[model samples]
Target: MKSTMANLWHLVKGVQIRDLGEKRYLFKFFHIIDMERVINGAPWTFNNHLLILHKLKGGEDPL
Candidate 1:
């Protein structure tokens, strides 16, 4: 009864989410503050496990 990643435009203007393959989604935000907010202020939760968000450096891919 709800939409996920449906109102991306409402969240960030001119932002685009691209599929980088391997079940990974890349989001480009225009503002560095937005990225910092996501990395430091965003809240993630799971049913039984803690959600870990990693910052991938340039030319780095998680295998």
Candidate 2:
């Protein structure tokens, strides 16, 4: 996950990945705009797993 985040670090100003238990994760991005790009142009696969992204109304907190 760290490597994948590093690869996309430029496009994204900030992010925090929290394991919400199970295999689910919560990705908090600094800008929802950048998050939109990731959602639209995503499923960023590295290795064999797809980097699934989802959008919600709110989930922003500066970590």
Candidate 3:
């Protein structure tokens, strides 16, 4: 899943997706612009399953 998403985004600075259990993932991008681009592109998918993207502010809980 990580490799798939990484390739899909083709981010300049790159990104890392950490499995957060129960199918949730934390996508960490090296650059702000890369992050913004992914967010703006929204509604991503994998294996026909919709991949939801969310931005968590500082101190915000992902769960």
Q: Which candidate has the highest TM-score of all?
A: 3
List where candidate 3 sits over 4 angstroms from the true fold.
none
Order of the predicted models by lDDT, top scorer first: 3, 2, 1
Worst 10 residues of 1 by lDDT: 1-10
Error of 3 at 12 (Å): 0.8
Q: TM-score of model 3 relative to the true fold?
A: 0.90
Better of 2 and 3 by lDDT: 3
Model 2 lDDT per residue over 1-63, tens place: 755775765555667778777677777778867777778776687577777665665565322
Q: List the candidate 2 regions with Cα displacement exceeding 4 Å.
A: 58-63
Give per-residue lDDT, candidate 1, residue 49. Answer: 42
What is the lDDT for 14 in model 2?
A: 69
Cα displacement (angstroms), candidate 1, residue 40, comes to: 0.7
lDDT of 1 by residue, 1-54 (tens): 002332422344334556667655666666666566656754644344443556
- Each model's lDDT comes to 0.51, 0.69, 0.89
Q: Candidate 2, overall lDDT? A: 0.69
Q: Tens digit of lDDT per residue, candidate 3, span 3-57?
A: 8887888889898778889989898899999999989998899999998888999
